[model samples]
Target: MKNSEEFDDSFMDNEKVVLQSIAEDLRTCLPVEAMLPSESLAVEKAQQNCKPTVHVDAFLYDEEAVDLLCEEGKMSRDYCLLCGSHRTAPLGFISHSFSALELRFLFQNVLPDLSGKMLVDVGSRLGAVLYGGCLYSSAAQLVGVEISAEFAKLQRMVMEKYDFTDRIQVIHADICTQTSLLQNADVVVMNNVFEYFLESSEQMRAWHCISQNVRKKGALLVTVPSVQEALAALQGKNGVINIHEWLEELPLDYDVYLGKDTDPESFKQIHLYRVL
Candidate 1:
């Protein structure tokens, strides 16, 4: 037990160092103007307009009090692996921070042209994508589709907080099944939300909807957690998983750009698909 305690302390120390390094990198890469306004505003909007979390356990856990020490390579049993919560609700500060990094990467590398075109963010949560779009591009229309009414209202509120309501629109609809509602868009983004649909058929349908909705030459930016992470969860541990085979299974309408992080197990792996 003494040896185990020492090992745990060392592991936590190493984790802290890595996290600090990442935080520095992010601070350097992401612009100051690209971040969310304030936590008070976000929390207030969530509390007032978003779904009542009092009822949903499908994606909620009192992480402050909950002690579920996930073993090395083991899944976090306290939260939903797909949505990162036991309940289907808005994201927290940590999740938003990670997402902002990915968004910075997207803005810098993936879709450089954000000016004068309509951009659609399927499953946009609390206007994060809209904020990214507004920061990165001068796109005429930044439309966001969210299935959860609570979330849609919160996104609307968030847009108002940024005074971007006139430019960004949040619709209450599911993009997967309601393809007709999604008109042709120049850029369509689905960040870290694709893996939620565990069924292959559902994934295929989502692709179809995205393909049909996007312009012929438009760009599609989607993020999937590293295969290693997915495997680790199932095996009660985490590691990096290759997406080569996974890309092959996706629709042939677009050529997917695979992103490889220096550390594969960091959940930083991303894939970008541009529709042909």
Candidate 2:
């Protein structure tokens, strides 16, 4: 990873333009209805017509471009249309995507070069992490496991629209059932999936499954909450247990890269660990 001082801001300025253009194309496919009962045919047609010419390499090395893409990606979501009405309120799943700025810091500064590594995103909603990998890291493969068929389809469409099928793949299946992916992944990113998406028992099951299947010894695991917090919550319910038996926290001693408008404290919640 290069130092922040070594990077040129002009490169990011150029890439931001290309990334923003791509985002504009993706927004065309977002359904107008907030709570869609079914997939819209219009959305599909819009995606087919949207041909994103920008390549991932255009923004891969620019830190500022990450913030730009992240902001633009927010437009892809379907918002609640009836928030102010007495009969209906704005209804939709809460956004669970990580900021692109944080992702750039994680992959480019925290982890070693990912030239031949396989990066897997658990419960990948909207494929934000996958896109971050495609545009910021050199990982050989970027895989996203999503349980929702709709979300999975959306991710696939975005990948196709951007011509990223060569390095990105989305699997429409529960992460727990995808043991092969877990065991084979060199880097696994779990971004607030367990806390908001799963019940208490299911969360335990997920942790147990990952502990048993994920690559051992050297594999990296990134999570939104600290390992201590997760272990404490589990232990409080099940009595004292040794979480160290499964994973260990890796101190982030390097300087985190941030965009001009980004606050460094915003990413203090992120935690990195090494699989045991």
Candidate 3:
């Protein structure tokens, strides 16, 4: 990343405008809901197993997008019970991918400069992080491992549409099979990958596979909700992976502001670790 202080305010503003434009263009390429038929399993799992309240995917629709949906009368921030009675509560939303602001925060704030680094996004749905990295960092390679063939096809299409083929590559395969690539990665990002999508047993398997391979000394591992929080549920099935010995948790400065589209709580969920 270049020194933000060196650039004039207008230049920084223009940079953000460019990224926002890309996000808008990407939105036009997909369905309004942004949940494709290819993601039926994930959508079903989210509906049945996620929290008791309404669950909204945060990847495709950020806070700003949600507000627009509310304006169109298609979605609501709060649902009224008893046929539009006054009693209502805010909706619970969840997402598997980073928003554009979050991605900007990631590339500009959390992670170090990636002038010649190779970063991999596990379960890289919609290639949001890849595009953000392409815009914010000078990473040599931004690889995405996605299990769904259709989603992978979508990612490739976007890459081709925006001429990002040189920097980003989408591989339609489960992340467990990419041991060598993980080993070679300078940075690996996992955004609440398996909790909702996989059963307890499958989560254990994927976590085990990740622990064994992404162990290059000093490699960075970024996870939403922290590694300990994510892996705690897998306790009984996951005696093989010990995070304290394998990775060291690093504190992040969530005090920094990314943009108006991002909230403070959103920044707190992101946790960074260093491979030991």
lDDT of 2 at 69: 52
Question: Between which residue pairs do clashes occur in model 3?
Answer: none
For 1-276, candidate 2 gives per-residue lDDT tens digits of 233444634346433354455444544555422213343432343344333111122112233443465477732213334566544332222225565566667666777788999999998766777877777778999999987787788779879888889999999997889999899999999876676456567677777777778855789998877767765667555344466777788877545545553546646667888877
> How do all models score by TM-score?
0.49, 0.70, 0.88
Best by TM-score: 3
Stretches off by above 4 angstroms in model 2 are: 1-95, 236-241, 254-257
Q: Native-vs-model 2 lDDT?
A: 0.66
lDDT of candidates 1 onward, in order: 0.48, 0.66, 0.81
What stretches of model 1 exceed 4 Å from their correct place? Answer: 1-98, 177-183, 197-201, 225-268
Error of 3 at 132 (Å): 0.8
In model 2, residue pairs whose N, Cα or C atoms come closer than 3 Å (at least 3 residues apart or on different chains), thus clashing, are none
The RMSD of every model to the true structure, in order and in angstroms, is 14.5, 9.7, 3.7
Give lDDT tens digits, candidate 1, residues 1-276.
Answer: 433544544443332343333333333433322223322433343345333221111111123212331343222333333555456434222233234334445565556576777788777755566766666567888898876676677567556655787789988876876565455676666654444323334444565555455534545545454333433343322322233322322222222221221122222355555554
lDDT of 3 by residue, 90-207 (tens): 7666777787678878998899999999999998877888888888899999999998787788789878877899999999998989999999999999997888678888889999
Candidate 1: lDDT of 240? 29
Residue 132 accuracy (lDDT) in model 1 = 64
Candidate 3 similarity to native, TM-score: 0.88
